[model samples]
Structures are given as structure tokens and as C-alpha cells.
Target: MRSKQEYMEKAEELIYKTYNRFPVVFDHGDGVFLYDTDGKEYLDFAAGIAVMGLGYHDKEFDDALKSQVEKLLHTSNLFYNVPAVEAGELILKASDMDKVFFTNSGTEAIEGALKIARRYAYNKDKSHDHEIIAMNHSFHGRSLGALSVTGNDHYQEPFKPLIPGIRFAEYNDLDSVKALMNDRTCAVIMETIQGEGGIYPATEEFLKGVRKLCDEHDALLILDEIQCGMGRTGTMFAWQKYGVKPDVMTAAKALGNGVPIGAFLAHGKAATAMSPGDHGTTYGGNPFVTAAAAKVLELFEKRKIVDHVKEVGDYLWEQTEALSQKYKIITAHRGLGLIQGLELSVPAAPLVKDALLNERLVIISAGANVIRFVPPLIISREHVDAMLIKLETVLKKHS
Candidate 1:
């Protein structure tokens, strides 16, 4: 194996400079611990940006993937595949939605949802509905369709002239959304818990209000659960906590527990938009990815993963609040389940760096000043205690 520095330099020369990567090169991992080529170990709290729900090298998950790979991989969507059907059914049963369309990533799922929403309107009166209302400070995905619905001007500025008929509303503010929605609106897409927007969760009242607005206007309610769903929010889905239902829901991230898979689900009228040959993909809904997702869902059922997330998530929230009160450097703390953010008095980048380098604890920074903590759903109480110790030490040093 090559040295970490040499490998990184080589990667820099070959790959695009899209990501400013950390200096560590992980060789392998198990549970919450990752070992680098230099024999250095780090406790991972970020969990690969909330993708690894069961943690690294989970035995049952690995076995399921390997078994499915050996049996079947891909056979194109021209023919039906068992894994696809199984995964889709599992997701439908898990969610309130009735049907599902698989995709390769979260952005693709968002794109599919957008298409369904638009097409549903087009099929309706054929003249009145086309616009989609998204929230300010929302992060859906990076694809053009998802980008168009995303609220940030900074991300949208470079990719000028995106999909038309998209409007912005203030997140968690019912009045802002009410002002923008009209007869032309086909959908209102938002995250139940905004992940990339600094872990902001929609208030229960706001979600219920939006649900009513969409119902009244006959617009599809599309919830983007890419980062906050699949047991990350203690429930199997975040919308369950909000006490409102969406006509269409997009999910990815932890659906396959690190394997690339995404899905868009719809209920009732929204499901009728797509007929055969209307939309399809070569790699989407392939056996390999769907197999992984099937196993993930299976584990979710067999292991009671949601309960684990609930216990650990509550512990994390309590500890974060305690830290906020003790340090006074932390301006605020907010979130549900494992999706948490600590708003610091100063920039959190230095603290994140210190956590990695000095404390050997891995964390991520959301926005500029908020430190994000999205550990694996299966993370133990012991792991949380360990992380709390390191976090306290790091915050004290920074203060």
C-alpha cells in the first residue's frame, strides 16, 4: 500500500478539486473506529455524513451484500428483478407512501419526485400547475433539478439559468410559504430536517400548516428525507415525527447503509403521473444496489435499529444541551435524534480539526459555526460518553 501523503498527492493530481479533504487515509474500519494506513485510529462520529447507519464493516450487512453480489448484480430494468421489488415494497411498508421509484443517488430521487410533481400537474388541467415552492436555507441535492428547488443563491449563482417555475419560502415560517404558493404551484418540496442547512428541523406546526396548504391547493407535498430519514431521526422517517404526511417523499443517504441507492415514493394521485417509458434509468433499481437496500431494511426490522437511535439520540441531545450550558461558548444546540448541531460562539472548523488531530475524534462542521454530530444509528452509549469527553476537552481549549 502507498503512504497516505503520497496517495493524497497522487489523487490531487488526478481528481478534480471539488473537496478539500482531510489529511487522514483510512485503510479499514469496524464499528465506529477507522484505522489509517499510518496505524492511527480515529473514532468516527460523522458516520460518513450520515450514510453509514450501522457503522463500518458491519458483519451482517457485509454478508448480505456479498451474498447478493454472488447471486445477481444487474439485468437492466427491461425485466423485473426481485431485489428491486423487495426493496421497493420494504420502503413502501416502512413509509406511508404506496409506491416507489429507485434512483442512484439523492439528487436523482429529487429529480424523479420533481418530474412526478410536474407531470401530475401537466396531466391535470394542463395549464394551471407547474411551479414548485422550496424553502430558504434548504439543501436538497446538487443535480440541476434539485439545485433549481434549493434556496441558496450562492449554490445557484454559478449554475445560472436552472429549471424555471421554482420559488423560495422562508423555512419554518408558514406565512412565507403561504405567500408564494398559488394556483400555478404543483409542489412544495422541503426537508423535514434540513441537514446541510445547519441541522434545522421543521416545526410540527409549520409542517402541519404546509400539509394543509398543499391539500387545499391540490399541490403535491414532497419531503426530501435524504439526510434525516431511515432511522436517523429515531423514527424510520422524519415526517413521522412532524405528524404530517407528504404525497411524494425522496430518500437516500442511509437507505443502503453506504451503498449508492436512492428512492422516490408517492401516494394516491401523485403515483399516477408516470407510466411505462415515461422515465427510466439504466443503473437505477439494479439488483446490486437494491439488494443492499433490502438487507438494510431487513436489519432495520430484525435489530430494532430505530429504538437504538431513539435511546442514543436522546442521550446525545441531552449531552449536547449540557455541554452548551456548561461551556457558554456554545450559542445554541438544536436537532432531533442523531442529526444535531452545536452553534458555537466562534468558527467550529478549528474545533473540528482539533477533535481529529489531537483527540482522534472525527466530526464535521455544518455552515460556518455549527459543529454537526451525526453518528451511526447503532452507536453505543459508551461511544457517546467517549465523544462527550473529547468534545468537552476540545471546547474548553477553544474557549
Candidate 2:
């Protein structure tokens, strides 16, 4: 087997320099832990950026994927497939949405939702351009259309002349959203809990007010649940906790556990926006991917994953709050369920690196100073306690 250094050198030579990767090369994962090439074990708190909800090396997830591989893989959109159909049904039932359009990734899901909102407005009247209201410090995706809606200037500036007709509003600020709405506004999109920007969950009052504004302005409410949905926040969808339903919602990441799959769901009038050939994907919702997604949904119910998350998440937060009190570098901590963050007085990149190299704990940073903890839904309190010990050790060394 190749050494980690050799693999890292090859990756730097062949792959795009898109990510500032860690030094370790992961070999495999089981439950909430990952093993490196040298067989060093590290507890995984990032969960592949909140995608591996079922954790790693689960028998059920593995069996479902292998079963689909033996039966069929791709049939294209021209033919009907049982796995895709079942997955769609599950999504609809879970979201209470009328229609579902599957995509290959979260960004594509956002793109599809944006298209549906625009087409719905065009179906009404195409006299003028329709605008979408997105939130400041929000992250939708990297695609052109999704990037246009993302409110971060750091991600948007380099990709100039992106899709126009998109406006930005302050997150959790209902008045900012209301001010952006007008006759030309077709949709208002945001993450129920802002992920990459920081672990900031929207207030119930703010979401309810935004929903009312969307209704009054004839704009569809779109929730980007790519990072926070699928039981990451102790709910099937984060919006459900606020008692607000978006006209459209995008989901991915944990939707398929580790398989590549995404979906955009629409309700009521937004459901009928796209007709026959308005939009489509060649490999979206293929049997292989949808089978994994279907199995994930089933496992979520059978394991009572949402309830598990609520329990472990509460314990994790309480520990984190205590850590904040102990460590002077920790300024604040915030989040819901497994999606939580610890804001530091200093830049968090160094701390994240230290955690991996010194403490053998895997985690990621949100924005500049927040250490985001998005562990798998199946993590127990024991895992949380282990992580806290390692984290505290690292913080003390730094202090």
C-alpha cells in the first residue's frame, strides 16, 4: 500500500487545488471513528461534512447498496425504476411536499428549486424578471445559479456576472426579508440553520414572519436544508421545528448517507411549475443512488435516529457550554442537535489542525472563528464525552 505522503503528493499533482486538505489520509470508518493509512484511529465529528448520518460501516446501509448493485444501476429518466419511485415517495411523505425532483448533489437540488420558483413566476407572467431573496452569510452551493443566491461575498466575488435578479437579506431578520419582497420577487431561500456561515439557527418568529411575507408577496418560500436536514437537527426537516413549511425545500448530504444524491421538493402551486421538459438530469435518481437514499430513510425510522440526536445533542451542547466557560478562547457556542459550533476569540483554522494532529480528533471550522461539530446522528453520549476530552486537551495546550 502507498504511504500517506505518496498519496498526498499524487493528489496534489492530479486533483484540482480546491480544498486545503488535512495531512492524514483516511483508510476506513466505523461508527463515529475513522482510521488513517497508518491505522491511527480518530473520532469523526464532522461526519463527512454532515453527510454520514448513519455513521460508517453499517450493515444495513452496506447491504442495501450491494443489493441495488446486483439488480440494476442506471436506467436513465426515460424508464421507471422502483428504487427511485420508492425514494421519491419516502421524500414526499417525510417532507409533506407534493412533488419531488432528484439531483446528483445538493447544489443541483438548489438549482432545481430556483428553476421551479422562476418558472412558476413565469407561468404566472413573464413580463419582467423575477428576483429571489437570499440571506446574508448564507451558503446555497457553488453552481452559478446557487452561487448567485449565496450571500457570502468571499465565494461570489471571483465568480462575477453570476445569475442576476437575486437579492440578499439579513438572516433571522424578518424586516430585511420583508423589505426585499416585491411583485417581481419569485422566491425567498435560506438555510433553516446557517451551516458554513456559522451554526446559527433561525428563530421561530423570524421563519414564521418570512413565510407570511412570502405569502403576501406571492413568492415561494425555499428552505435549503442540505446541511441541517435529514435528522441533523432532531427533525426530519429543520423547518418543521419552527412550524413553518417552505413552498420548496432542497435536501442532500445525509439524504443518501454516503451515496451521491439530492432532491428538491415543492408544495401546492410550486409543485406544478415544471411541465414535461422544463428541466431534467441524466444520472439523477439512478437506482444505485436512490436505493441508498430509500434505505437511509427506512433506517432513520427504524432506529429512531431523530430521537437519538435530540438526546445526544443536548448532552453535547451542555458539555460545549461548560467548555466555553473553562476556555477563555471560546467566546460563545450555539446550534441545535448535532449541528453545533464553538466560536473562538481567535481564528479556528489552527485549532482545527491541532485537534487532528495532536488530539487525533476530526472537526471542521465554520466561517473564521467557529469550530463546527456535525457528528453522525448515531453518535452516543460516550462519543461526545470522548471528543470533549480530546478537545479540552487541545485547548489547554494552546492556552
Candidate 3:
């Protein structure tokens, strides 16, 4: 096989230069570890940006995918497939949502949810309620419709004249959301736990208040759980911890255990507005991807993954909290489950680079100054201890 440097050089030549990726080439992985082409090993704490729920090359997930490939891969929405139905059934049963619309990615799910929110309002009264209120520092997606609702000015600045009628509010601040809600507001979208803006979770009281405000105003409450859902934070959905249910919910990331799949769910009344021909996707719920998703759900039951996440997440938080006191450069540690973040006094890019090159630990950043830890749900206590030791040594050296 070619060396890592050889492949990386070719990638820089051929691939789009949009992303400033780390200087490493992952060849294959298992559980919470990855190996580069140079035979170097690294503890994979990023989990492919929170997508690899069961970790790399999970046996059950792989077996399901192999079986699905041997059978029918896809026949489109023109006909029904068993894998798609099974996945949808599990999602609905778990979430108590009335219906589901599958898509290929998180951004597409966001778009579909936004469309449902607006279409539901339009059906009631056209041209009246069209505004979508989102939160500041929140991330929905990169597509035009999803991007319009994202509240970051930097991301939206280049793409001027985006889809209008989208307003911004402060996350976890009930008054900011209430002030933006009016007759024109069709829906309010937000991440239950703000993932990209930093791993800042919404206060329980704040979420309850928002639910009441949306109910009182007759506006749809949309929760974007793309990152924090799917057993990442000890629950199937983060909103479950808050005790508030949204009219519309979008999820992806870990839905397929690594396969590209996203779904937007709607409750009884909100789902009714979508008709047969209103929306569709070419490869949204293909049998191959949905089969992987079904297997992931099955593994969840067999493994009791949620309970594992709760235990491991608490252990990680405690270890990280201790590291915060030992290292002055570390500011704070915040999160629930495996989805945690550490805030640093300075930019964390260099520390991350050092972890990869010097310590052989693979972690990603949430923002400029925060390092996000979202390892595979199958990761054990021993894996956590190993990572913590390497990470702590790197932080001390940098400090």
C-alpha cells in the first residue's frame, strides 16, 4: 500500500479545498480506534463527526449491510421496502411522532422540516405566517434553506439575500424567543443542545417555557437534534431530558451508524399538512441505508446502549472536570453522555494538532476554542482512561 503522505498529497490535488482537514489519512478502524496508512494507531474520539455510533466495522451493523446488499438495495418510494418501513417504525415508536420523511443528510432533513412548518402555516393562512425564528450560534445545516435559519452571521454573510423571514434569538433565553414570536412566526427551530456553537445545553426551565410559548402562539416548535440525538447523549433524543416535545424534529448523524441517512418527524396535526406529492427524495430511504439503520436500532436494544452512554458519559465528565483544575489553559467542561466539550483559555487548534501528531489521539473541535469529545457508544471505560491520559499529557505539554 502507498504511504500516508502519498495519499494525502493526492487528496490535496484532487479534492475540494473547502475544508482545512487534519494532516492524516485514516485507512480503517474498529471500535474506538483508527489506523492510518502508515500503520500508526489513534484513539478515535471524533467518531467521524458523531456519525459512527457503533464505532467502525461493528459486526452486527456490517452483517446487516451485507445481507441488505445481497437482497434488494432500493426500489425507490414508488414501491415499499421492508428495511425502510422497519427503520421508520422504530423511529416513530421511540419518538411517539406521527409520521416520518427520510432524507440523505442532516441539511435535507432540516429543509424538509422547514418546508413542513411553512406549508402547515400556509395552508391555514397563506402569506400571513411565514417567519422562522431560530437561535443565535445555532447550526441547522449548510444548504440555503437550512443556512437561512442558522443564526451565525459569518456563515450567512457570504451568502447574502438568503431565504428571508428567518429571525434570530438567544439560545436558552426564553424572553428572546418570546419577543420574536408573533402572528408572522410560523415556527421556532433550535438545537436542544447547541452542538456547533459549543456544547451548550438548553436549561430545562428554558425549554419548558419555549414549549409553552409556541403552544400559546399556535406556532410550530421544531427541534434540530441532528448531533445530540440517537443515543449520543444517553437518550434517543435530547428533548426527552427536557420533558418538552416538539411538533417537528430532525435527526441524522448517528441514525445509520455511519451510513448517510436523515429523517424529519412530525406530530399528528403538523404531519397531516404534507400530502402524497408535496415532497420526495431520490435516495432518501434506500434499503441499503435503512437496513443499516434498522440494525443499529436492533443493536441498541441488544446492547442497552443508552444506559451505557449514561454511565460512560458521567465517568468522562468527572475525569475531564478534574483535568480542568489541573490545567489552567482549560476553562470549563460541559456536556451529557458521550457528547462533551472542553473550553480552553486560548484557541484549541494547536492542541488538537498536537494530539493527532504527537499523542496519536483523534478529536475534533466544536468551535475555535472548544474541543468536542464524541467517541463511539461502544467505547469502554478502559478506552476512556487511555484517551484521558494521552489528552492530559498533551494539554500539560502545551500549557
Q: Which is the leading candidate under lDDT? A: 2
lDDT of 3 at 244: 94
Q: What is the lDDT of residue 392 in candidate 3?
A: 88
Per-prediction TM-score: 0.98, 0.99, 0.98
Q: Evaluate candidate 1 by giving its C-alpha RMSD to the native, one decimal.
A: 1.1
For candidate 1, write residues 1-399 as lDDT tens digits. 788899999989999998898888888888998888899889999989999998999999999889988999999899999999999888999997888999999999999999999889988887743799999889888888899988898889999899988999999999999999888999999999988888899999999999999999999999999999999998999999877989999999899889999999999999888888778999999999999999999999899999989998999888778889998889989899999999988998999999998899999998889999998888988999999999889998999
Global lDDT scores for all candidate models = 0.91, 0.93, 0.90
- lDDT over C-alpha atoms for residue 77 of model 3: 88
Q: Give the Cα error of residue 334 in candidate 2, in Å.
A: 0.8
Ranking by lDDT: 2, 1, 3
After the best TM-score superposition of candidate 2, give how far the Cα of residue 43 lies from its true spot, in angstroms: 0.3
Tens digit of lDDT per residue, candidate 3, span 1-399? 767788888899999998988889988997789998878899999999899989998887898899889998888889889998999998888788999988999999999999898889988877754898999999999999999988888898998889989999999888888888898888999999999899999899888998898888888999999999998889889999877999999999999888999999999678897888889998999999888888888888788999999999889988888888898898888898999999999898999999999999998888889999989988888998999999988888879
- Top-scoring candidate (TM-score): 2
The number of clashing residue pairs in model 3 is: 0
